[model samples]
Target: MPNGGSRPIFILSEDTERERGRDAQRSNIQAAKAIGNAVSSTLGPKGMDKMLVDSMGDVVITNDGVTILDEMDVDHPAAKMIIEVAETQEDEVGDGTTTAVIMAAELLEEAEELLERGIHPTVIASGFSKAASKSEEFLEAMAEEISIDDEEMLTRVATTSMTGKRVEANVDVLADLAFRAVKQVAEESDGYSIDLDNVKVETREGGSVNDSSLIDGMLVDEDRDHPGMPRRVEDAKIALLNVAMEIKETETDSEISVTSPDALQKFKDYEEGELREMVDKVKEAGANVVLSQKDIDDIAQHFLAKKDIFAISSMSSSDIEKLARATGGTVVTSLDDISSGDLGKAGLVEERKISGEEMTFIENCENPKAVSVLIRGGTEHIVEEAERSLIDAMSVVSRSIESGKTVAGGGASEIELAMKVADFSDSVSGKEALAVRAFADAIESIPRILAENAGMDPIDTIVELRSKHEGNGKTWGIDAYSGEVTDMLDGGIIEPLPIKTQAVSSASEAAVMVLRIDDVIAAKGEEGGEGPPAGGPGGAPGGMPGGMSGGM
Candidate 1:
């Protein structure tokens, strides 16, 4: 080159940092899109499963978008951002896991174009935050009308929550059960706990609800016998009969030899009377039955039977303690050691039923409200899936009830808010006008997401197209899936659906945030492990592209 000639080292440089930064942003956007597409089809009750196999041949099949994303072990930075969004949604709402994942993916897609045009990500993020706040405000204003006062509306809430599955067995039935359980607990005592843990909903085809009964104490499965032994106990009392006849043993398995003949005779006489007195003492202590771990001699057994006392041999120590707790009694080891105070009392078990659902309540328990939900299924896998669904349903439904209110389904409120924003788009100030327009566009996606998940073509559907309608029998805009459609009003389409409003809010937040970042630092050390730790503005000594700080 110094000699004014072309050389082998042909170097035409632009700015490597700028170039790489763009690449990183693109990579992030692409990764999010992949995750979104992966979960998009898997929304709703009829959603399908994603079968993922790890490098080690481990396989997982689940329709849960969060589960799929979590198990995939994503490495892309942008993909990780989407995963973080899913985690945030899961951490907050027990439902909406899939919706969050897919919506985040859609946001990145929308941001990629703006990023290509040299607009800074920070500006986009700010717009997104503003829009999100406005959208939430609009939703709140619309939420005042949807109330939980009516029982019919309560069932509707349950039905909406259970939308897309085979829950027809009884959404109303389950809701009523939950309501009654809450009422019962509230009526029973002050400061009572109303929880799914205490109120069980078991589905037994043949089990009658009329068979429900309350037991007057606690019933924990405390079996001390061998595992295969009988599980049920009936009409039993404290039995403290000891099998050992003699009071003293001189040696192991050896008959004792007394030095004095009178001493030996006295020993024999004392042993005979002591055994009889031990039995009588226990009977006086109110023990109607006796259980002996050691072998009972014939004399003691005959004497006990004659006294109308029933004795069972070979009782386990654990079962004895269990019996004691159940009957509010204490375990007696020796009959001679028994006293009237040692015996506790137990009452009869009662049964009642309602609506063909059987419930068991333990009466006289230390805590009367303590109940367990025993979910049953025809098969193991079916039961497991049902259990998972029930747990999620219980959590969401309980929170909704306790909160006493929620917005309409299918994102109706959010769509209404977006419409309001669009209606006033012409009156907004300077940069915010553009931001508001973007916000409206973002809000409109809510319905598309819902329709797409619901097995309808959102781009070609009436509801999705109607969201962009400008009134006066005219609708013109690019559909969410990049399709062009007009005449939405003539198609007789109405307002945005509930799921749509939710999806728009979520997607807008995510998409706007992606375009806000201008710099990405990915440091990998030569040691093949994590790079050195660093944070904030000082960390970028070499300078970053677009003069953006690595603080984010």
Candidate 2:
């Protein structure tokens, strides 16, 4: 439009925003570091908790890295990516999310120094890739094999996970429960494998944490279906049914017309006869207890009560399936298919009132593959926190058993990894060696944070750890309770090998991905007004306004 000509000339929009080269990298690194600092204080056993208040005024008090990140209202794209690192760590390993995020931020910090030295991003990324692979080798070599039957070791692993949580008061009891629950569900075909779903945790408030116990069978938050049903049945023969005890309706809409009183009476008799037949079939199955996933009709209830069957209806399908596993019962879909062979045996099926609500317990299964851990606490919040602690404990124990190896916790493993990686870095030549050494330095953040959180001088503690690791004391880690360097394994602080390995691997990958980005083009906001016209010049298709577009 310079000469008022008809020919169109494309021009960049005024609203677009962009950052190139070092500016973009600095911005992203700053965002990631900020997020890391936000969660740094909540790193170790002595770490403090963060109280996050949402827009709705709901408050969450936790030191869990993933939970805190999930609750925060992060908006920066770089910060969100860091949060994803924590999330992936949590989803894959269930713990050490804080370790992962902190390490990634530190790596970026080190990489920023390299970038300032005129080192190319690709060289830094390639060095990180090599360091990460070397770290994995160090981890596997340093790990010690653990057997699932080693209850003491497993309990130590669980205790280490719950050390800083709200359930510290009952950590011993919860740790024992978590260990037992995981072992109960662990399969040992090729190697130890645990399906965490098979270990169910049910929480109930108003009781002390010490009151929590592990059940050999499933616990259902349900009561008897009818008032006339037995409240307790000993040596119970359980029949699990997924189909409804009530009569089925037609698939499509239909009309039932009663022309006269005689026709209505005949219809009622036919319905009553069908209900009676269904009850008789259940009775013939020799089941003293009935747990149905669907509702039971009043007529069927009356018939069941007449036979003194302990019937509980309206159970969830998941609960029914779990019950089938716990009681060794087949879930029958139809009454006609129920037989003595389909019944599951339980020593007792009883309705007990807990917290003023009746809950049915199916206990004393011969050898239940699926088990329940009933968590009890004086308050709802305590119970919920205990549940979270138990979940972490369970996950760690299962992870340990599956991997069949564990390493010292409390930052011991990280120090050893750092030392080994540093030695490995010495063999490499070129500027990438400097990057690899930077990667080694980045891993020191874990032990450093652990010391700082425990009120010890981080530099002194790190120096002491390095000296111990350089000598014969490989498992020496900071003892948070005393702020002294001690053997983590001897201190009963241990973690599965996968947690540390995954944290380092994930953090390195995230750091490399972030470092490779040299340009950031952020789009302009489209709020408060209409966007650019569809297919318009300088606009994306579908009327979407064009964002800043540039390259470094």
How well does each candidate superpose onto the true structure, as a TM-score?
0.56, 0.93
Clashes of each: 27, 0
Residue lDDT tens for model 1, 1-552:
344565555253322122246655665566667767767776654456677788998666556556677786544455566777777665544456677676666556656665666556665566566666666666555442222344455445554444453433544444444333433333223322235444444443333222222333433222221222222234434453334432545666777578998998997777767767766776777765554555555666666666655554554554445445445565665555777676644332222242343222223433334333444445443344444455444444444454444554443443456676665557765555555666666555655665565566766654644544435222332232223343322321212123333444556666666555546654442343233222211122212222223211
Itemize residue pairs with steric clashes in candidate 2.
none
Off by over 4 Å in 2: 1-14, 528-552
Q: After superposition, how far is residue 529 of candidate 2 from its true place, in Å?
A: 9.0
Query: Residue 240: error of model 1 in Å?
Result: 24
* Candidate 2 residue lDDT tens string, 310-367: 9988988888988988999999988878999999989999999999889889999988
The candidate maximizing lDDT is: 2
User: What is each predicted model's overall lDDT from 0 to 1?
Assistant: 0.50, 0.87
